[model samples]
Target: METIQFIHSGWAYIVLIVLVIATFNALIKFFGNKEFDAKDFRISLFTLITMHIQLLFGIILWFTKGYFDEMSVGEVMKNDAVRKLAVEHPATMLIAVALVTIGYSKHKKKLVSKPKFKVLAIFYTIALALVLYMIPWNQWF
Candidate 1:
């Protein structure tokens, strides 16, 4: 379980970096009116992979931390720190991963450059925002 935590924490850096790069790439290329190229495809795919891996680790870490054993919803909600780690972090991270997933797939199906960039920009940006907002920065850092 400690190993799980270690891996999750370490992997978070990669996830953050890749996601930022992908989002920025999408935005820059979209605004530049550049064609979505193979590099773009690879970056988006890599971001999706990185995020899903983090989400999997987070779920495992959450369960091992015994958050479900929390006696009641109110009890869990009442404690701000525990609540942030146990509930808010995972929930928001999950949403972020889902958004990245959707963005990757949606962009893939688009035939043209602008729509591809638009899809990736929209969802990946939202995912990045959610991730940045929800990470347990106090504890993790």
Candidate 2:
């Protein structure tokens, strides 16, 4: 459980870096009217892959922590920190991942460079915002 937690925590850095890179890349390219090529595709794919890996580790950590077993929903909800960890964090992260997945899928369907970058820019930016918001700063530092 500790190992899983450690991995989840550590992998979050990778996810963040990749997500930032991907989001910025999309935004820059879209605004600059640059062509979407293999490098762009690879970056986006890598971002998706890293996020999914982190999500998997997070799910394992959540289950191993036994949050639900330890507290009733009401009890969990009543505590802000507990609520954040047990419910809000996971839920928000799940939505973020979904957004990234959707962005990747949508970008793939676009035949033009600008539209692909635009789709990726919008979705990845929103997802990155959520991820930044949900991360536990105190615990991490």
Candidate 3:
């Protein structure tokens, strides 16, 4: 359990770094009217892969922690810190992952450079925002 937590915590840095890079790359290209090429595709794909792996780690950590077994839903929700760690973090991260998945899929379907970048830019930015917002900054640092 400790190992899982450590890995999940460590992997979060990679996920955040890739997500930021991908989001910024898409936004910059979209605004600059740059062509979407193989490199761009690879970056976005890599970000997606990293995020999915993080999600898997998170799920495993959540189960291993036995949060639900430790407390009732009401009991967990009553405490701010517990609620944040047990519920809010997981739910928000899940949504962020879903956004990344959707963005990747949408970008793939678009044939034009501008549209592809636009899709990735919008979706990834939102997902990045959520990820940034929900991260347990104090704990991680």
Candidate 4:
């Protein structure tokens, strides 16, 4: 369980870095009217992959932790910190991951550079915000 937590924690950094890079890249390219090239595709794909991997690690960690086994749903909900760690974080992170997946899929369907970048920019930025909001900053740092 500790090993899983450690991996999840470490992988989160990569997920965050790639997500930021992908979001910023898309935003810059979209605003600048720059053509979407192979590099852009690669970066977006890499970001998606990293996020999915992090999600997998997080799920493993969550199960290993057996958070619900320690407390009832009411108890978990009543405690702010416990609620954040046990429920809010996972739920928000899942939503963020879903956003990334949807963004990547939508971008792939767009034929033009602007539309692709625009889709990526909007979705990734929102996803990044969610990720940033839900991260257990105090625990990680």
Candidate 5:
């Protein structure tokens, strides 16, 4: 459990950095009317892979948490700390991940360069905001 937690925590940094890079790259390229080239594709793919890795680690961490045999759902939710970790954090993060996934796929479907960047920029920016919001600040670093 500790190992899983540590992995999740440590992997989050890579996820964050890659996400930031991907989001900014998209936004800048979109505004500059630059072509979506190999570098852009690679960065977005890297961010997706990093986040998915963290997601897997987090799921393992959650399973090891013993939420199944312990307190009632209502009881868990009533406690602010528990609710944030067990419910809010995961829920919000999942949404953020979905946003990134959507952005990646949507951009791929766009035949035009500027539209592809626009799709990436909007989706990634939204996802980045959600991820940043969901991070457990005090417990995390």
Candidate 6:
């Protein structure tokens, strides 16, 4: 369980860095009127992959903790920290990953560069925001 938690925490750095890079890349290219190329595709794909991997680790860690095994849903919910860790963070991250997935799929379906970048920028930005918000910054060390 500790190992899984450590892995999840460590992998979060990669997820965050790649997400930032991908989001900024899209935003810059979209506004700068640059063509989306292979590099752009690769970065977005990498971000998606990393995020999914992190999500997997997180889910594993969550189960390993077994919060519900010891406490009721209401008990978990009443405790702010526990609720944030067991519910809010995971749920938000799931939605963020879903957003990234949707954005990637939508971009691929677009025929033009601007639309692709636009889609990526919009979706990645929102996902990034949610990720940033839900992250347990106090426990990240």
TM-score of 3: 0.98
RMSD over all Cα atoms, model 3: 0.6
Give the per-residue lDDT of model 2 (tens digit) for 1-141: 999988999999999999999999999999999999999999999999999999899999999999989789999999999999989999999999999999999999999999999999999999999999999988984
Pitting candidate 1 against candidate 3, the one with the higher lDDT is 3
4-105 in candidate 1: lDDT tens per residue? Answer: 999999999899899999999999999999988999999999999999888889888988989758557788899887788888888888899999998998
TM-scores for candidates 1 onward, in order: 0.96, 0.99, 0.98, 0.98, 0.97, 0.99
lDDT (Cα, 0-100) at 59 in candidate 3: 95
Go through the candidates in order and give each one's C-alpha lDDT: 0.91, 0.96, 0.96, 0.95, 0.90, 0.96
lDDT of 5 by residue, 1-141 (tens): 888898899899899999999999999999999988899899988988888788888878888997645889989989999989998999999998888888999988999889999999999999999999999989998
Residue-level lDDT for 2 in candidate 3: 95
Per-residue lDDT of candidate 3, residues 1-141 (tens digit): 999999999999999999999999999999999999999999999999999999999999999988889799999999999999999999999999999999999999999999999999999999999999999999996
> Each candidate: RMSD to true structure?
1.0, 0.6, 0.6, 0.6, 0.8, 0.5
Candidate 2, superposed: residue stretches over 4 Å from native = none
Candidate 6 residue lDDT tens string, 1-141: 989998999999999999999999999999999988999999999999999899899889999999999999999999999999999999999999999999999999999999999999999999999999999999996
- Of the candidates numbered 3 and 4, which has the greater lDDT value? 3
Instruction: Report the lDDT tens digits of candidate 4 across residue range 23-141.
Output: 99999999999999999999999999999999999888888888789899999899999899889999999999999999999999999999999999999999999999999999995
Candidate 4 regions with alpha-carbon error over 4 angstroms: none
**lDDT, model 4, position 67:** 78
Whole-model lDDT for model 5 versus the true structure? 0.90
lDDT of 1 at 76: 89
Whole-model lDDT for model 2 versus the true structure? 0.96
Looking at model 1, residue 37 earns an lDDT score of: 90
| Residue 65 lDDT, candidate 6, scale 0-100 | 95
